[model samples]
Target: MMKIEGTLYPWRFRLVLALLALMVAAIAIRIVDLHVFDHDFLQGQGDARSVRHISIHAHRGLITDRNGEPLAVSTPVTTLWGNPKELQGARAQWAALAKALNQDPKVLTERLEQQAGREFTYLARGLTPEEGQAVLDLKIPGVYGLEEFRRFYPAGEVTAHVIGFTDIDDRGREGVELAFDEWLAGVPGRRQVLKDRRGRLIKDVQVVQNAKAGKALALSIDLRLQYLAHRELRNAITEFGAKAGSLVLLDVKTGEILAMVNQPTYNPNNKRNLEPAAMRNRALIDVFEPGSTMKPLSMSAALETGRWKPEDRVEVAPGTLRIGRYTIRDVSRTEGGVLDLTGILIKSSNVGMSKVAFDIGGESIYSMMQRLGIGQDTGLGFPGERVGNLPNHREWHKAETATLSYGYGLSTTAVQLAHAYATLANDGRSVPLVMTRQDNVPEGAQVISEKVAKTIQGMLQQVVEAPGGVFRAKVPGYHVAGKSGTARKTSVGSKGYKEKSYRSLFAGFGPSSNPRIAMAVVIDEPTNGAYYGGLVSAPVFGKVMAGALRLMNVAPDNLPPPEETKAAVAGESSKPGKGDRT
Candidate 1:
């Protein structure tokens, strides 16, 4: 049998034949897999070598004011990205890219070196169309520009604080941008394309997802009102030589913020040189001891508690009252002995209000303030809103209660004070202060009886109409009621008030017959010979309110006679708080 097999085939030949058959079978199997069974896998492997990934950016949403005016928007832009691993003449390429990107070559070289093995590195963000094209013309390998968007603030500094700004990645960084980031940011998209050896796209492999642009947002602000407020605020700041200033106009019925302005505001378009003080939205963020502006709250508390009436009398001995070891005195040193509740408000007597607060007791007074929305957020949705410092009743010292009565011990933001006044103007029902419109009017929680509110309103009106009171804020044809607040700024190391620095505030609501607008204006450290709220801040309030009322188309209740309307002489005392005198 061995002899017969040897004769039939040579050993080497048999071995070669066996190896050839095995090789042929392996080839057939591989062909089948590549052609049919596992074609998708093999195709993916081929694409892996030749395909390039590119990102498609989705457009960011638009920001419009209440009247559909564009405050901020997204405009087409380009971003340059590169594959450092594929870059040739790394130094020259980097230098060219840096020149185009307006960046330092040395910094770019370092970035490229760090990302040597990386497939992608951002060379520059938010390039203009011309700049993007210049880079594209360089024809550098591994470098490409993608279409994107950059935020544009059309109203510039006027709408800066309200609209805010975005980061490089089109994400909100501050203000409304930060508050509504999710709604403002849109979904991104991606594409895979086959590229030739030269990195030119040859074919599309797949489209993973389609990009969706962000939805548009409408705000409650009016651009015209915003501009008016800004211009007036700047002029006031400059004229008074004040340290800073803020003004806010509110819709009395709905509580929608019509205009909010803070001086030392920054241009959102050029934020590189912005100062911290300029960026602060003082309306909602800064808190101060409200001084006599808070007396109305104290008096209302006293009246609501049935311990006192608008006609109740208090003895203002020496124009001062001593509580615990502390003594409270009126701003005016001319002493008066007996005063009614209305007289206390009209005179803005700290001595009288302290007695009233004592009559109301600490708990009821604090509870009333809490219900009036003081020491709380106004639900305005603004960033960094401070629920201004209000000490617990249990923690209150006798001095704290007495001083707080006349707005000394506690601190509050301008917005909170405005909201409190708005509550009073709204007939003792507290509506949620809003920045956006709602379909259904929010039901207000009753803070005081309508009777108490009416009495307080009448007394406050007297504060404006009375000759001795500080409210020379009356416009010729309209009824106005408000209080002037003057508080010596608290110093860090000083035991008492700062020598020359004081916070002056004027807060009021208009057209007493039918209140429509509620506003607050504050001037910090006015240096041009006047420091009282009535002297420095109220006139600005009058001008702004006059403009706002005209814009609102409210019929004038009391137009001045032609003689009264004549421009006052340069040095005449036109009115107590008129700008001419200030």
Candidate 2:
């Protein structure tokens, strides 16, 4: 026993034990140093690999009509994304991934190789929920889908010119979509999410910021009236073989735009081949000489001056009037006879209007037109709204004054014309045009005296009801008051007007006994041998007005009996018309 205890093996065993103890003590010290002094660094390093800040998409708002009918809505969609850092090495599974994503394998390989260093990249955009789910079900590592909102239009092309459309990221691009984009596109959110090295989402850590959904917007349009107007206007434009056209309907009392439609319109939902021309909301954007539609304003100014009465005579005798070298003629009727101001309007006599203009003074004429919302922003807040041109009256020559009085030498949009006519219909109360629904309407300014306004409204009724006037503008059971305007189109990039190319326009209100609606129809370059506003535009007014009056439950002013009128109104309201289009 003494010999074994005294061996060198005993000393070697002791030394190995001491070495092992020292190594354990060193490890303990290092661990204490790391846990105390480098805690933040270690935690940060770990979080850097697993924690990621991600964006949470907020859906857009809903756009509805006055009746709570949806015009625009946000639809949930998925966008497939890939993490190139992980997907770059998953070449073997790429074929399956490509198949699930409905992409070519070769293209997938090229995309992955190109974005090898990127942590995130788009694989497919705007995919259906099922399509994205199928891609994800393949268990392809590094591939994920992001939730997104896409703007969709329920009313399609019929409301396209007004509602507009959105971009791929659900951003409003045109029309109402662009006008109220801030209220339509909501704010996105930020959150920290846990992810593994493969870039798969684990769990949401905490929300850094909350997302806000867009607010709902209600437009002033009545869908029923809107559809009827669209049908009638499209039919008119097509029947006349017009280059383009626009129609605007308004509630005269409230200044609410019930319907505003344009031809050459495109589907906002399907914008694959959208044309810029088709996208124009011509009723508000395009301007032209309003033709004889402006005569009422001139007569109003004349009446306000106390210089002209309804029966006041303007000698359109010889059917022509000469001022300097420029001679104006009444082409419609040249019978040399003294007629009242009402008769002058019925004939659309340029000579009579010119004579009235000189008598009333240009300054007086300009005041009423300006008050009627011409050459002004409509306050509708529509994007790309053009304020029409009104030249300074102080600089008006005799010729210019004459033409201005008869709806020339001044530019105006369909919206402007309709607004002006509505003012007259509402007894000279000028209300701001509203595009959104307003439960409490604003106060209107009296632009003209009630007596003068009513007189003009009465005179306009004669234009529709009078023989050889706008005979086609008459409604079956209502006393219509409107004017037909045939304006020569101004030649493009030239001085003179285009021959055989005319803009047919009809602007007025309905149920002359008590005006409820005011509308304007303008057909540009009607080429099917019917260029007269009475023949082309006035018929559209009759059909649409017939439907609109019934839809609004407006009592017929000239119907036979309640029972007979009910059948007529019902049938007429549902009747369809054809269009003459480009």
Q: Candidate 1 on 426-520: residue-level lDDT in tens?
A: 88888888876445666888889988887888888888888787555877678888888888898878677888999989888887777788888
TM-score of 1: 0.87
Where model 2 places Cα greater than 4 Å from the true spot, the runs are 1-49, 206-210, 334-336, 561-582
Q: Which candidate is the best by TM-score?
A: 2
Score candidate 1 by lDDT: 0.82
Each model's C-alpha lDDT? Answer: 0.82, 0.90
Model 1 RMSD, rounded to 1 decimal? 5.6
lDDT of 2 by residue, 1-582 (tens): 456653748888788889999999999988887899878888999999999998989988899999999999888889998899988677899999888877898998998998899988999988888888888888777888888988888889899999998889788889898999998889999999999887789998999998899999999999888889889888887887899999999999889999999998999878889788999999999999999999999999999999789998878778878888878888776465777899988999898888989987788888889999888889988988999898875576898889889998899999999999999999999999998998986789998999999999999999998877898889988998988899998999999898798999999998999999999999999999989898999999999999999999999888687798799888887766623354
Pull out the clashing pairs in model 1: 477-558
